[model samples]
Target: MDLCLFVTHNCPLGCSYCYSTPKMDVNMTLETAKKSVDFALSHSHDEFQLSFFGGEPLLMWDLMQKATAYAREKCSEKSIPPVFTVTTNGVLLDEEKCKWLKDQEFHIAVSIDGNDRMHDCCRTYPDGSSSHDDSVRGAKIVQAYYEKFELVSVVTPENVNYLYEGVEYLIKEGFTDITLNPDFYSEWNEAQLDNWTEQFKLIGNLYIDCFRNNSPVRISFIDSKIITHLKNGYEQCDKCRFGLDEMAVAPSGNIYPCERLVGNDTGEHIIGDIYNGFDVQRMVEIKNGNGFASNEECLECELAPRCMNWCHCVNIALTGDMNTTDGIVCFHEKMTIEIADYVGGVLFSEKNPAFMARFYGLR
Candidate 1:
């Protein structure tokens, strides 16, 4: 089981496509955090992932440290191994923080959209000043401590044209693992979608070139598609089982299936709270109400096996109905699969050593 604690609702930066907008000055209580950990451990059999998330989780540094200590103690008592991770906007990540995170063996993900021009398009400070430099500096600092930290890049329509260059720049800056996210709520016209496809193709070419040059990297969007193809469809892990394998706890103690759904800590869509325990009936309703099998169009579609249409959080966030499929997600999956197959085909045909070794287990 994976448990995420929304430690704080205060952020220093004002990102353009931020889902947690209208940020508040709220923080989670240390007692609530410990109880959240205990609640998550009750669901896990052997291992658990405890992650810190927020408007800026690093803002509540003391809470994070205490919560981690409490979780570690609990896990030790329960004989379960606990894994830790944190996703940060990267502005507040300094040397001391990085060193502590490294000592704790926390899996870190730094948010850096791309280069300065591409990044500053959406991620900026309160005064609208450039946060690009600070973000990049933090990423570099994290990289110095951990060789395999994740670099999360959110692609918006404004910076869609720079997708290929953005990824290439990250690779040049020594980031090996990258995840690209699209602002699904943003307006995307046909032209922009077409450009998105082209940019991905350029990225595909870059991916092949990297492997050929002996410096292979992992791009989450592309790697997932290729791996899904290898498996012939989306695996069990690929699909989201809302409130089942993973859950999030808001600063107010309201429980949600995903962190993205915890907007403003509103009581809407809350399954339960730390004090009340999970609403079993409501949880069943939510889990049963969503899936590709529920939608007739998805049932009839040929790509149903590999499509991510069953993600309830994404569907609800974009269309307000978990059962309905959004055109944006449909289009994104199709384009990504097409590009991934193309890239996979080229590398497979050439028998790229690194690709073969990584995917095919060929020594």
Candidate 2:
């Protein structure tokens, strides 16, 4: 299900790390929006999702209203309604916008790091001051308006040191759900993994704290990992939602599985033109692991089944092969697995009291 009818490419803030390669350089038009919704319903996807992302989504706020209404009407015609999600920088979110999102019951993800210093380093405006203050304000309004919204912090080396502080701040801000991602807008290298470990370790501790405090906020990383550990699946993802062959439509009506994959840096993955119709069979092939991608070092990892080689975007960035079999991952599955094992021994089996003493690999 192409849950993303990627609305536009034009954004107000010029973030240095923005990774946008438009299928066509255009703004969202009402007719194109209608056609996109029609395309989704045509597939009879049953339950559909429409997510608004952008250079900055609010830049096209008026267009979004029209598209949202049209999507609803299209779904009605197909005897199915659409669920909406928006990922925004929060520069433009205000009282009225929040009311509309709440009224529509859209799932929203706001972008912000812990404090001003961290937030500005990765996300900024043309003048390059920092969007931290405004983003925080917008996040507040959005959270009040949309109960299910979340905050996504783009992790950078500079901000990596502050992961604990950011987590504490987000929890205190009343946002229970958060996504802390490595800042991919920059180049990938070995140096970044150390930062990721620090962040993940903090997150693991946060889960322990959550358990102790009876926190209702869902920590995606640890909670999902726990679920996967219990179910014999992925550490965070139960099933590869992207593996299901989801698509992202650009402003000009071109379709691809995800925005990250749609970058001009690699355009062969763009399946079809939305103006016509998506190649359903082609899409199925890609979704089912039949698509062409180069798998690099991942070809040797033992954790392939669980991690599925991590994400395609991350793999390409790290190893230059979007299709690496077990290409390195963000959370460091090896580390997480070790942590999970240690957690089991310490928290479950007092039979292994020497756990901390055993970061050393046993003979």
State each model's CA lDDT, in order.
0.89, 0.66
lDDT of 1 by residue, 1-363 (tens): 899998888899999888788889988999899999989998889979999999999999888999999999999998998899999998999999999999888999999998887888888997889998899999999989997989999988999988888899999999989999888889998899999999989998999999999999999878989888999888777786678888899988899988888878877779898888899987888867856745677778887787888888888887787778788998998988999999999999999999999889996
Off by over 4 Å in 2: 21-25, 184-192, 235-245, 264-268, 279-302, 308-310, 316-322, 325-331, 337-363
Error of 2 at 233 (Å): 0.6
lDDT per residue as tens, model 2, 169-243: 888888888776656445445666677666677667665555445464555554445445555655443443552
Model 1 regions more than 4 Å off: none
- On lDDT, the candidate that comes out on top is 1
How many Å off is the CA of 318 in candidate 2? 4.7
Error of 1 at 177 (Å): 1.0
For model 2, what is the error of residue 16's alpha carbon versus the real structure, in angstroms, after optimal superposition? 2.5
